[model samples]
Target: MTTTAAAVAPKPTGSRTAALSFAGTLRSEWIKLRSLRSTVWCYGIVIAITVLFGILIAQTASATFASGGSLTQEDQQSYALLVSTLGIGFSQLVAAVLGVLVISGEYGTGMIRSTFTAVPKRLPALFAKAIVFGVVTFVVGLVSIFATALITAPMLPKSGITPDFGDSQFLLALVGGALYLALIGILSLAIGTIVRNSAGGIAASLGLVLVLPPVLQIIVAMTQAEWAQNLAMFLPDQAGGRLYAYAAEASVTGGVIVLDSLQGGLVMLAWVAVMFVIASVLLKRRDV
Candidate 1:
């Protein structure tokens, strides 16, 4: 028999992005995010926990201040912010878990292999997932914080902690708080991408976002070193929290904050950016 020319598939002719468009990746990611039951439940729980703790804090603050309980103006401001954000740390855990699950679940279930096959250039896929998830988190957090603020408004006035929603500074602080949560969500996604394991990602994320800040604080407390104590405020979570109050909080470092509220928000954003860059590089270099 005559030798026949072996058939070969045509190579992609366009740029990688043109050949494997991000629109498809973005659509697929959105679909995948919605399809997962855990996504719905975790978000639902996040919302519930946020509101539940807010109510409890409001009630507690109301009772504590009902008799015009010992309160200073400065303390009232702090307490107002605290009551409004009581569930932030708790909801952060839920958001962090969801972030880890979003990426790590694919690896855990062998879906990542299929994913990489569809889009050989992996970083776009990761970016698409992050953008979709980050936007969702930001929107949800904004709405939740707005609701919490309104719900706790009655209690705040009673506690002499009233913050005028119309006041730009107060409004900025509220917006900053929600933005902070959204950043945490994205940051956790970076952790998941880096680790490529569900539990490991979650644990690492919690450790970074929750445990490390306090541990730093403890170190400061134990050492009582001025430098060490002030350094604590520069950590991601602490720096982010600085944006949650109307006034610039005293530096843990005992130095004046040269940067304003917007700068503090930028600090948190910088942390997320660094993590994303690292995760993207690793995602590109590593095997699925």
Candidate 2:
């Protein structure tokens, strides 16, 4: 048979050569995020935990009040709504889990190879995931807090816990809880990008948030070092917690978070910015 060679065509130009826009990457990321079954589970778990825990706690308190228990102060009871929203603490773990999975799961499944191929400019992908996941987590956190507060508010009266919806602390706590979780999502996503293993990312993120604070506390106690406690205050979780706090209580570790909300938020963002830069640089330099 006579041999013939087929010539390869030149690549298409203009739009075909155009890089993916940041907005397009964001929308694509959002679609991928929402499609995951874990996304649904994480949000559901957080919201359910908030509402159910609030109800159960409120009922227990009502029983105690009926049996003659009383709060130490009237104002203490007014914080009942904010108290019910303590579910955010647990919800943060779920957010961290999801955030890690957002990037690391792709790596585990080898989908990240495809992702990097699609956008050779890798940093935009990271930014898109962070923004989209952050928004999701923030909305989930906000809804969880507000739903718990609404559901528990009426029942709180039976428990001798009066909740003032108009209370400044209450409002700030709700908004702050959402903002806090959103930042957690971003921080964990950055960590996930850095670690590139779902379990490792999850563990590192949680260890940073949950494990580090108590470790600092122990160190503070053992060494009687004021700096140890002060250091704990600047931790991502600790600083994020301030967003929902009624007061900026002093920590014994070296991270002593200031009383100012703006300062605490800035501190949290500072951590996010550092990790974000690290993740971005690594993503650019490393293999998919």
Candidate 3:
């Protein structure tokens, strides 16, 4: 009798040995974002546009005044801040696209399933991505705004103008500029999470953050609605700016405003919390 050779079972091809923890997921996201070409280009553009516009506007405004025109110190300071923040509108679009890609690119490339398999708990992946995007974007915004201010300051003196960064309003505007971009970044990430489709996520984010507020402003103007105006002030963008302003003006302004800095920060935080809650629910419930 010949004995058959014993069959050997194939080694397990799939093992759960390399699961991703929250920190690991966050680190992976950071690596992915840094490795992407679009992230580099978008951030470069943001800084370039902000500085260029700040200098151009400051130079032009200074020229206009020097040509026998009049502009107050406050006006010069406010306009300088506006110039630095000019990229805010377009930068939000870049940020929204980035946010969409962070989530939707995986789906588009069929990597999302792999990601889900690695993590198993879907919400951690989403949270990790959001944290990464938010922190990176916020830091970028701060750097851009600070650099723009520094560059624009010397340029202003050439036109015989100088802004007091120590001035309450000027400081407030600077902080406001940075916070506005950060809020936009967070808002875009939320929209991206809610809408898994890249195009859909981007469109929805643009509509909600950029389009909706202006539309609401027009409506409020047409209807003369105080409530609408008040509501608009609490929007993610507005509330964030207000918080920054309040921080910058904390010592000088001192309880003069209806809503304090804490209140404004809370309002913005509430918006973020709501978006995260919705996103988490969808992430858990959806088939992704």
Candidate 4:
């Protein structure tokens, strides 16, 4: 029989045909991040430093008050801000080291080969890792800051330092501190991805974040050069430091440049953006 047979087509299976989504990549990255013991230790150290330092500062201020030392309202606010944010200076280094370890560890262990293989278009993995790490870091930083504030709030009253929680500037300082930590971590991650070695990544990250600022300060002190001072203001640490600075007034005076929170944030974002671009390009071109 020469009957025409109906055309038949194979239906695609959902599992085989489904593409790897960014959300799926993010979830995978998050799984890897949370599974690491280093992540737990680093985050623990961050929280401990923040809370413990806040306690120490609050106690010191309380003792001062008990000994009859006094501060004006502005000074009190300054002290409160310091208590809440003092740990950020130290915590940032920890966060940076953690950031480096996150990527460099993968490379060190050769898991990056598998990582890239799973996601043939490698940039998505890089971005997924960055986004996952950055968001977690920001949340952790925020929690640590707010926890310190809450723990120290009662103690501050003993120092005649009552914090106005509703004040916009005070709230901004707290939020800014967290934001700075996130950016610093992401910047370190970009550095780590480019370097692709744990020790080298750490050294490079610290050189830029820790060593450069003080070196520039020393040069400024030696020469009192206006350009040197202005240049230092744009360095990552210096610019990021302004983000958490409370009630920093914009200087209209010549030879004095002060970055408000927004200015500092933009500058720090620029630093991260530039490094990330370089890292992305290298990651795409380099062999795993």
Give me the runs in candidate 2 sitting further than 4 Å from their true place. 1-15, 63-74, 247-258
* Full-model lDDT, candidate 2: 0.81
Q: What is the lDDT of residue 143 in candidate 3?
A: 86
lDDT of 1 by residue, 1-288 (tens): 899999997877774454568998999999999999998898888778778888898888777877875666557666766767778778878888899899999999999998888888898889899999988887787788778888888867766567566666666777777777778888899989999999899999999877887887787678766665556656667777767766764432345233456666788788889989999999889878
Among all windows of 10 consecutive residues in model 2, the one with the lowest summed lDDT is 248-257
For model 1, what is the alpha-carbon lDDT of residue 45?
82
- Model 3 is weakest, by summed lDDT over 10 consecutive residues, at 246-255
lDDT of 3 by residue, 11-127 (tens): 796852866678899998899889888889988887887778777787786676565545677666766676667666567667767877778888778888888887888888888
lDDT (10s digit) by residue, model 4, range 1-288: 699989897776754755688888999999999999999999999999999999999999888876666678777777899999999999999999999998999999999998887888988998998899999999999999999999999998877898888878888999999999999999999999999999999999999988988988899899887777888888888889889888876663469587887898899999999999999999989888
With a 3 Å backbone cut-off (N, CA, C), the pairs that clash in candidate 1 are 230-252, 230-253
Question: What TM-score do all the candidates reach, one by one?
Answer: 0.85, 0.86, 0.82, 0.92
Report the alpha-carbon TM-score of model 4 versus the true structure.
0.92
lDDT of each: 0.80, 0.81, 0.74, 0.90
Q: What residue runs in model 3 are displaced by over 4 Å at the alpha carbon? A: 1-18, 67-77, 158-160, 166-176, 243-262
Q: Identify the leading candidate in terms of lDDT.
A: 4
lDDT of 2 by residue, 1-288 (tens): 999989998876855766678888998899899899999998899888888887787777677675565565435544574566677778888888888999999999999988887789898888889989998888888888887888877787766677777777667767887898889888999999999999899999999989999999999889977677668878887788888776445433344435456667888899999999999999999978
Off by over 4 Å in 1: 1-18, 69-78, 249-260
